[model samples]
Target chain A: MPERIMPGGVMSGVIEAVISLLLVAGGIFVFIGSLGMAHLRDFYMRLHGPTKATTLGIGCMLIASMMYFWSVDGKPDIQELLITLFLFITAPVSAHLLAKSGLHLRLKHADKTQGKPVELRPEEVGDKPVPHPDKGHG
Target chain B: MLSIALYITLALVVMALLMNLYRLTIGPSLPDRVLALDTMYVNSIALIVLLGLWLNSKTYFESALLIAMLGFISTVAVCKYILRGDIIE
Candidate 1:
């Protein structure tokens, strides 16, 4: 491994190692998350993967980005942190909203899903009157 | 080492993006497609960050941040539309 000599004579080997580790780890998590998104049998089941796993994956990558910029610029970059915080905050909220919308639509769930609702009648969904995708269009 | 790691990460993120595309394409219901899109945004953020590191470019930082902000807003808006049949009502 060739050593990288930073502008200020900073020892870059350790920082680079840490960055590389974080990058590789984050990449793997990201791939796993996407894999789950693609291969899952049901919508709710598919929701489980990217919401949590990909958020953490990006968080790892952002941290490595922070470290890389900090080492090069000789100052900690707060922008990456902003993204990390934004993603962490929004990921769950979006997931919740997605699930709620799914519920509102009475989307089908896999039979094997533990705790799957036995039935979702339209009236039980409340006064809004759930829009039936079939009756409205076809 | 860092560049090599960046390249590897870039490839992985690209693959992730492709998988997300697959989900978006075949999602059976509206919410499913929306979820796929939301995941796509997050994956793209990772992709942008990886590119920034690979090119040693500082300009990509703002773009990444912008993507994060916009992606979240769009996801929320679309979800709200799905739930209420309208965004602002």
Candidate 2:
């Protein structure tokens, strides 16, 4: 545990302002993501939002946190960095997996969603493409 | 100043969680539900990090890290099960 540094100056105020800005921006992005998830008409379109939340939204908040701790503790906290990196890596992978599964399940897309996957066969997906619960629907 | 911003962000995140819950409850497809869950956990991590900042403690970072790892693994596992019928093959 590093000794807390109580830096009382204009820099402190500036850092706080920055952190506040980051927090508000991150919050807004997160809200927007969820809003899209809730209101978007199709599964594929819905998937578009959360990836933003996971990357930019969480990324902003994490940076603000790192800045917060560094100013207060006088040492850069690496845990937030770890989370940021892990999210940047895993968010895309999970999104890919979700999209793949969606395609496997034949999830319906909005009519406007373009560049649909063509000729995706079930056997081509996995060793055995499991019969999904929503097998009958589009 | 910091506290005010934290509160507003807190409210936004909590609302985000609620929206996620709504999607989880009524998502038309399995992947949508899974995506909702994934987003839920990520939002929770943000909430946890914010809590740590508000309380001025460092302990929450470990929990946030753990949640990130677990969330990603669970999502991948569920997706694998959905695709292949078996989790580990």
Candidate 3:
């Protein structure tokens, strides 16, 4: 009877361990971030929670993926990098737009929360009237 | 050892997903829900990457990328709707 051993089995084991550690850490960050989102009283504060967590958490996980693939296949697997880049660029923009809209809608928060007052846009307040200084001449 | 670590990672990700779900359900306003959903999208991307590692396949990375792109667009559209009451002019 002969014992069989899979090729690259040991190396795969090491790679998997590393990737798993990376993922667990990333997940912890994400979980904490979500908790912040759920527990925060104000919309603006909640906005910061997810933005920081999602970006860093996703970035870490993507790097883990890149590491795992590069180790096993010995090439720079760049797909994960592209995903990270996309997330980084868009997360802040989306958060900003949402915050701006929240302000526009006058979303209120609990007392003791000191957010800057929403700047009333001229059009929103109906304060911008057409110029009528010369209307009598017409 | 590797299996144990993978299982732990999976558990943590699942916990994160559950937390995000809670936020989505308890959100008091529309933007709150939108923010929670956006967080879920980001978490989902991370989950996909971890799945790729566990399954030992690079194909899942593509799905993660797709989610990132689609999630961003959807969030933007939702924000626009909330701001102006319409997505298209």
Candidate 4:
């Protein structure tokens, strides 16, 4: 009869399986995010797609990297932690600024699936009526 | 075991890179392009980290860090340009 595998071997196998699952799951999330980027109609909505995916997906990949390195060296591997930190910090801010700039440029939102702009009342414009000579002309 | 994981991660990263390229190519608006470029930068950093793992070298982390820092600056510059029509003004 073949000898049974040791508990330690089984445990290692389980850990490896978990890491593999994480890598595949992260990849799927990234692919979905890209699909969202492609399918979304408006630039503002598209901004969310990659930002969410890259942050979370890169995070998952970094965790897998840290785990793999720690297992091999028998010590904590911290470089991935730094990369994760950088991603978390920058992704949102960059996305926000990009979206804001898009709005500032008055780029027409592409979701014409909805109808024309609803005109706002004078009070809605509030505090600042049309710039005297510049309005209803340009 | 480690090598296998590294290769799998590399393949995934390359796939992600291709997706970003698609976004960069066909993005409808300027900000859309910028957003794709930003995503590409982040993915590139992740790719570098994976490469470091595959090569068993700590040195590649430096490039990863540089990518992160420079990537942010570039995004900010692009955003500024979009908002003001000039990066410096």
Candidate 5:
């Protein structure tokens, strides 16, 4: 019956079910991740939403795509595989850069974030000037 | 049966896209909006993949790739603009 679902290659009934299930799961994960983005209070917390949840979500979708094309199209399409690789490689780099930019701009951080950002004035940046009133002549 | 399942999945993904839109529009900070846009693009890829399956087409694959590249580049560009007023510099 499941094999009848496709007009293409050699997918069995069980494999079809698995692929569909995976697709649904991936969709749900993507939704949850986006939901976190909308719902979380702070920007850094919001970063977690897309970076962690959506990354996994997209990864799942790519795997399902790979499996579906491999069996139904009768060719092991590596395009999805490449996307998967590209996403996994880039997601972290983007997240790190985004977070770095956020920190660099001195974006407001949640109270719970450890290691509070140092308040560096533009003039006092170089030579590691100590913040002692005794040496505080500007 | 499979069609029915795919339809349900499509609805869920659409709902997610709506959420991303909400964040993109009403997010308090620039970073929040940028994050929303990033997540939205990723969600769009998922939607395109689902649409491809529904229509039994492969051409959407190229579109998805384009979205992936553009989304990343735009995000980094915007973040750079935020960190420094000039993107090129």
Candidate 6:
């Protein structure tokens, strides 16, 4: 009963309230990000959706989880910390690779897109193609 | 009070996953499908972590971590295959 009574004060109530708000905020961000991904007109434009908002959304959720564990168990959950780090690192890399593949395929561009990359013919080269730097290993 | 919040968060995250599924199925192009799949996995990870919070169980922690790792690897591998026509040199 003493342990239960210990966590029922005004300050703890405030902390729990904040955690609730964060959970809602994070979920909302995730919902919006997915909405953009599904509704966007072009693949390239869709790439922007999950990369930014979703990453932030998950970050907020993890932070709330971390705090919750700390408050309940009296120990910080370091795994959430590691997960946050991994997520931030990977979200961009995946987005970049997806976009890169789309560009490599020369997928259709939106009507107003500018600065589309032009494929240069072999004869249009400014100079001879340089040999691979590591080809001597052969 | 906290449980109610957890329930709402769970509902929203599931809705996001549903959107991802919609994109994956209705995709016009292969890369678009791949992108949807990638987002789906990430959303699942968030869902799993949220479940862990609600259950207050440490068990789901490792699973969430593993999903994060595996999801990233699979996404990158698939993207590479699309980009280069092969996953390895």
Clashing residue pairs, backbone N/CA/C < 3 A, model 1? none
- Candidate 4 CA-lDDT value: 0.71
DockQ of each: 0.62, 0.65, 0.59, 0.44, 0.53, 0.62
Docking class of 1: medium
Error of 3 at B40 (Å): 0.8
Candidate with top DockQ is 2
- Candidate 6's C-alpha runs over 4 A off are A1-11, A119-133, A136-138
**Model 2: runs farther than 4 Å from truth?**
A1-11, A117-138
lDDT for A47 (candidate 4): 79
Q: Report the lDDT tens digits of candidate 6 across residue range B1-89.
A: 67788889999999999999999999988878988888888788889888787666778888888989999999999987876667765
Q: How do all the candidates rank in terms of lDDT, highest first?
A: 2, 1, 6, 5, 3, 4
Better-scoring candidate (DockQ), 1 or 4: 1
Model 5, A15-88: lDDT tens digits are: 87888788888878888898898887778788998898888888888788778777766778877877788778
Q: What would the per-residue lDDT of candidate 2 be over residues A59-100, giving only the tens digit for each residue?
A: 999999999988877789888999999998999999989988
The digit string of per-residue lDDT tens for model 3 on B1-89 reads: 54565567678777878988988998888989999899998888877877776677787777787888888899999987877767865
RMSD of each: 5.5, 5.9, 5.9, 7.3, 6.3, 4.4
Candidate with the greatest lDDT versus the true structure: 2
Q: Residue B2 CA error for candidate 5 (Å)?
A: 3.1
Off by over 4 Å in 5: A1-10, A119-138
TM-score of chain A of each: 0.80, 0.79, 0.73, 0.71, 0.77, 0.78
Looking at chain B only, the TM-scores across the models are 0.92, 0.97, 0.90, 0.92, 0.92, 0.93
TM-score of each: 0.88, 0.88, 0.83, 0.77, 0.84, 0.87
Error of 1 at A53 (Å): 0.7
> What tens-digit string does per-residue lDDT give for candidate 1 at A1-138?
244456888547888899999999999899999999999998889999999889889999999999988898888978899989989988999998887788877778888875433454454443355556767832
Winner on DockQ (1 vs 5): 1
Worst 10 residues of 5 chain B by lDDT: B80-89
lDDT of each: 0.85, 0.87, 0.77, 0.71, 0.77, 0.81
